[model samples]
Target: MKYVVTTVWKHPVKIDWQSMRQTMSKSKDNPHVAEIHWYEIDETTHGSVAIYHSRDAYEANLAFMQEHRSNSISERGIEMFPRSAW
Candidate 1:
Protein backbone atom coordinates (compact mmCIF):
# COMPACT_ATOMS: atom_id res chain seq x y z
CA MET A 1 0.00 0.00 0.00
CA LYS A 2 1.05 3.57 -0.56
CA TYR A 3 2.52 5.38 2.41
CA VAL A 4 1.57 8.93 3.16
CA VAL A 5 3.37 11.11 5.68
CA THR A 6 2.28 14.45 7.03
CA THR A 7 4.61 16.70 8.97
CA VAL A 8 4.17 20.06 10.66
CA TRP A 9 6.85 22.26 12.15
CA LYS A 10 7.39 25.74 13.50
CA HIS A 11 10.07 28.33 12.98
CA PRO A 12 10.54 30.43 16.08
CA VAL A 13 12.87 32.67 14.13
CA LYS A 14 12.86 33.96 10.58
CA ILE A 15 12.73 31.31 7.87
CA ASP A 16 14.68 31.15 4.64
CA TRP A 17 11.81 30.54 2.25
CA GLN A 18 14.04 30.02 -0.77
CA SER A 19 16.07 27.37 0.97
CA MET A 20 12.88 25.68 2.10
CA ARG A 21 11.66 25.43 -1.46
CA GLN A 22 14.98 24.12 -2.69
CA THR A 23 15.12 21.46 -0.02
CA MET A 24 11.57 20.34 -0.68
CA SER A 25 12.22 20.20 -4.39
CA LYS A 26 15.04 17.78 -3.73
CA SER A 27 12.48 15.26 -2.51
CA LYS A 28 11.84 14.56 -6.18
CA ASP A 29 15.31 13.07 -6.42
CA ASN A 30 14.14 10.03 -4.50
CA PRO A 31 12.81 7.48 -6.95
CA HIS A 32 10.44 6.06 -4.36
CA VAL A 33 8.73 9.37 -3.84
CA ALA A 34 5.37 9.63 -5.57
CA GLU A 35 4.34 13.13 -4.62
CA ILE A 36 5.16 15.83 -2.09
CA HIS A 37 3.66 19.19 -1.34
CA TRP A 38 4.45 21.95 1.11
CA TYR A 39 2.09 24.47 2.60
CA GLU A 40 1.80 27.16 5.21
CA ILE A 41 -0.15 26.02 8.25
CA ASP A 42 -0.11 29.48 9.76
CA GLU A 43 2.20 32.41 10.27
CA THR A 44 4.83 30.45 12.13
CA THR A 45 4.07 26.90 11.09
CA HIS A 46 4.56 24.92 7.89
CA GLY A 47 3.24 21.56 6.80
CA SER A 48 3.95 18.93 4.17
CA VAL A 49 2.40 15.82 2.75
CA ALA A 50 4.58 13.14 1.19
CA ILE A 51 3.43 10.06 -0.64
CA TYR A 52 5.68 7.10 -1.21
CA HIS A 53 5.40 4.04 -3.34
CA SER A 54 4.97 1.82 -0.29
CA ARG A 55 5.75 1.44 3.39
CA ASP A 56 9.20 0.18 2.48
CA ALA A 57 9.80 3.23 0.34
CA TYR A 58 8.63 5.49 3.14
CA GLU A 59 10.96 3.80 5.60
CA ALA A 60 13.87 4.22 3.22
CA ASN A 61 13.00 7.85 2.73
CA LEU A 62 12.92 8.29 6.49
CA ALA A 63 16.60 7.48 6.71
CA PHE A 64 17.48 9.88 3.93
CA MET A 65 15.27 12.53 5.51
CA GLN A 66 17.05 12.21 8.83
CA GLU A 67 20.41 12.90 7.24
CA HIS A 68 18.98 15.72 5.17
CA ARG A 69 17.36 17.21 8.28
CA SER A 70 20.65 17.15 10.14
CA ASN A 71 22.55 18.72 7.27
CA SER A 72 20.01 21.40 6.38
CA ILE A 73 17.27 22.15 8.92
CA SER A 74 19.35 21.47 12.01
CA GLU A 75 22.24 23.44 10.63
CA ARG A 76 19.90 26.34 9.96
CA GLY A 77 18.77 26.32 13.64
CA ILE A 78 15.28 25.23 12.77
CA GLU A 79 13.32 23.67 15.61
CA MET A 80 10.16 21.68 15.48
CA PHE A 81 8.58 23.39 18.40
CA PRO A 82 5.55 22.09 20.22
CA ARG A 83 2.19 23.49 19.13
CA SER A 84 0.84 25.79 21.84
CA ALA A 85 -2.75 25.48 20.63
CA TRP A 86 -2.88 21.82 21.48
Candidate 2:
Protein backbone atom coordinates (compact mmCIF):
# COMPACT_ATOMS: atom_id res chain seq x y z
CA MET A 1 0.00 0.00 0.00
CA LYS A 2 1.00 3.58 -0.56
CA TYR A 3 1.61 5.21 2.79
CA VAL A 4 0.62 8.83 3.06
CA VAL A 5 1.75 11.28 5.73
CA THR A 6 1.10 14.92 6.42
CA THR A 7 2.94 17.07 8.95
CA VAL A 8 2.63 20.67 9.97
CA TRP A 9 4.80 22.66 12.31
CA LYS A 10 5.87 26.11 13.37
CA HIS A 11 9.54 26.87 13.57
CA PRO A 12 10.93 28.12 16.84
CA VAL A 13 12.07 31.03 14.71
CA LYS A 14 11.13 32.47 11.34
CA ILE A 15 11.17 30.07 8.38
CA ASP A 16 14.64 29.36 7.11
CA TRP A 17 14.60 28.53 3.42
CA GLN A 18 18.22 27.48 3.30
CA SER A 19 17.82 25.01 6.14
CA MET A 20 14.45 23.86 4.84
CA ARG A 21 15.85 23.07 1.39
CA GLN A 22 18.85 21.31 2.84
CA THR A 23 16.63 19.22 5.09
CA MET A 24 13.94 18.34 2.58
CA SER A 25 16.58 17.23 0.12
CA LYS A 26 17.19 14.26 2.39
CA SER A 27 14.01 12.72 1.02
CA LYS A 28 15.70 12.27 -2.32
CA ASP A 29 18.37 10.15 -0.67
CA ASN A 30 15.81 7.67 0.71
CA PRO A 31 14.69 5.10 -1.85
CA HIS A 32 11.54 4.27 0.11
CA VAL A 33 10.18 7.76 -0.25
CA ALA A 34 8.14 8.35 -3.41
CA GLU A 35 7.80 12.12 -3.20
CA ILE A 36 7.19 15.10 -0.93
CA HIS A 37 5.14 18.20 -1.46
CA TRP A 38 6.09 21.06 0.87
CA TYR A 39 3.96 24.05 1.72
CA GLU A 40 4.65 27.32 3.44
CA ILE A 41 1.66 27.89 5.69
CA ASP A 42 3.08 31.24 6.77
CA GLU A 43 6.32 32.90 7.76
CA THR A 44 6.84 30.45 10.55
CA THR A 45 4.48 27.59 9.82
CA HIS A 46 5.13 24.82 7.31
CA GLY A 47 3.59 21.59 6.17
CA SER A 48 4.33 18.62 3.95
CA VAL A 49 2.61 15.75 2.23
CA ALA A 50 4.90 12.77 1.92
CA ILE A 51 4.20 9.60 0.00
CA TYR A 52 6.07 6.40 0.69
CA HIS A 53 6.10 3.07 -1.10
CA SER A 54 4.94 1.17 1.99
CA ARG A 55 4.15 1.46 5.68
CA ASP A 56 7.56 0.10 6.57
CA ALA A 57 9.13 2.74 4.40
CA TYR A 58 7.28 5.43 6.27
CA GLU A 59 8.36 3.99 9.59
CA ALA A 60 11.94 3.83 8.42
CA ASN A 61 11.74 7.42 7.36
CA LEU A 62 10.50 8.32 10.81
CA ALA A 63 13.32 6.48 12.48
CA PHE A 64 15.87 8.11 10.24
CA MET A 65 14.38 11.51 10.83
CA GLN A 66 14.19 10.98 14.56
CA GLU A 67 17.79 9.95 14.65
CA HIS A 68 19.15 12.59 12.33
CA ARG A 69 16.71 15.51 12.42
CA SER A 70 14.20 15.24 15.19
CA ASN A 71 14.62 18.88 16.01
CA SER A 72 13.29 19.85 12.62
CA ILE A 73 9.98 18.14 13.26
CA SER A 74 7.41 19.12 15.81
CA GLU A 75 7.60 17.35 19.18
CA ARG A 76 4.26 15.73 18.37
CA GLY A 77 5.86 13.88 15.42
CA ILE A 78 4.56 13.14 11.95
CA GLU A 79 0.88 12.64 11.19
CA MET A 80 -0.20 9.71 9.03
CA PHE A 81 -3.35 8.69 7.19
CA PRO A 82 -2.83 5.54 5.16
CA ARG A 83 -5.04 4.24 2.37
CA SER A 84 -4.96 2.18 -0.84
CA ALA A 85 -6.75 4.70 -3.04
CA TRP A 86 -3.53 6.41 -3.91
Candidate 3:
Protein backbone atom coordinates (compact mmCIF):
# COMPACT_ATOMS: atom_id res chain seq x y z
CA MET A 1 0.00 0.00 0.00
CA LYS A 2 0.98 3.58 -0.55
CA TYR A 3 1.50 5.75 2.52
CA VAL A 4 2.19 9.39 3.12
CA VAL A 5 4.58 10.08 5.94
CA THR A 6 4.79 13.63 7.16
CA THR A 7 7.77 14.77 9.21
CA VAL A 8 8.52 18.07 10.92
CA TRP A 9 11.87 19.23 12.15
CA LYS A 10 13.44 22.53 13.05
CA HIS A 11 15.37 23.81 10.07
CA PRO A 12 18.92 23.06 10.96
CA VAL A 13 21.59 25.64 10.36
CA LYS A 14 23.09 23.23 7.91
CA ILE A 15 21.24 20.38 6.36
CA ASP A 16 23.49 17.36 6.41
CA TRP A 17 22.90 16.36 2.82
CA GLN A 18 25.35 13.50 2.84
CA SER A 19 23.98 12.07 6.05
CA MET A 20 20.42 12.54 4.88
CA ARG A 21 21.21 10.76 1.65
CA GLN A 22 22.77 7.90 3.52
CA THR A 23 19.80 7.62 5.84
CA MET A 24 17.42 7.51 2.91
CA SER A 25 19.52 4.91 1.19
CA LYS A 26 19.29 2.73 4.26
CA SER A 27 15.55 3.24 4.56
CA LYS A 28 15.15 1.89 1.05
CA ASP A 29 16.34 -1.43 2.31
CA ASN A 30 13.61 -1.77 4.91
CA PRO A 31 11.60 -4.92 4.31
CA HIS A 32 8.31 -3.11 4.75
CA VAL A 33 9.23 -0.40 2.33
CA ALA A 34 8.81 -0.85 -1.39
CA GLU A 35 9.71 2.71 -2.44
CA ILE A 36 10.05 6.24 -1.09
CA HIS A 37 10.01 9.78 -2.37
CA TRP A 38 10.58 13.12 -0.67
CA TYR A 39 9.43 16.69 -1.11
CA GLU A 40 10.69 19.84 0.51
CA ILE A 41 8.29 21.80 2.62
CA ASP A 42 6.86 24.94 1.07
CA GLU A 43 8.09 28.31 2.27
CA THR A 44 5.10 28.64 4.55
CA THR A 45 5.41 25.14 5.84
CA HIS A 46 7.48 23.82 8.71
CA GLY A 47 8.35 20.31 7.61
CA SER A 48 8.79 17.90 4.73
CA VAL A 49 6.83 14.91 3.60
CA ALA A 50 7.92 11.52 2.29
CA ILE A 51 5.72 9.24 0.29
CA TYR A 52 6.45 5.58 0.67
CA HIS A 53 5.12 2.30 -0.58
CA SER A 54 5.20 -0.38 2.06
CA ARG A 55 3.41 -3.37 3.46
CA ASP A 56 3.36 -1.70 6.87
CA ALA A 57 3.61 2.02 6.31
CA TYR A 58 3.51 3.00 9.98
CA GLU A 59 6.36 0.72 10.88
CA ALA A 60 8.36 1.94 7.91
CA ASN A 61 7.84 5.50 9.06
CA LEU A 62 8.94 4.74 12.61
CA ALA A 63 12.05 3.05 11.35
CA PHE A 64 12.90 6.02 9.17
CA MET A 65 12.46 8.49 12.01
CA GLN A 66 14.48 6.38 14.40
CA GLU A 67 17.33 6.16 11.98
CA HIS A 68 17.40 9.91 11.51
CA ARG A 69 17.32 10.59 15.23
CA SER A 70 20.06 8.06 15.83
CA ASN A 71 22.18 10.05 13.43
CA SER A 72 21.82 13.10 15.71
CA ILE A 73 19.04 14.77 13.83
CA SER A 74 15.75 15.64 15.49
CA GLU A 75 12.52 15.04 13.63
CA ARG A 76 8.89 14.53 14.46
CA GLY A 77 6.48 12.24 12.71
CA ILE A 78 3.33 14.20 12.06
CA GLU A 79 1.14 11.69 10.35
CA MET A 80 0.80 8.52 8.35
CA PHE A 81 -2.14 7.75 6.17
CA PRO A 82 -3.07 5.50 3.33
CA ARG A 83 -3.53 7.02 -0.11
CA SER A 84 -6.78 8.88 -0.42
CA ALA A 85 -9.09 7.94 -3.25
CA TRP A 86 -9.80 11.58 -3.88
Candidate whose TM-score is highest: 1
Clashes of each: 0, 0, 0
Best by lDDT: 1
RMSD of each: 4.3, 4.7, 5.9
Worst lDDT window (10 residues) for model 3? 77-86
Each prediction's TM-score against the native?
A: 0.76, 0.71, 0.48
In candidate 3, the residue pairs with backbone N, CA or C atoms under 3 Å apart (3 or more residues apart, or in different chains) clash, namely none
Q: What are the per-residue Cα lDDT tens digits for candidate 1 across 24-60? A: 7877888988988888877667877778889888777
Superior candidate under TM-score, 1 versus 2: 1
The 0-to-1 C-alpha lDDT of every candidate, in the order given, reads 0.72, 0.70, 0.51
Model 1: lDDT of residue 3: 82
Candidate 3 — which residues are off by over 4 angstroms? 41-48, 52-86
Model 3 TM-score (2 dp):
0.48
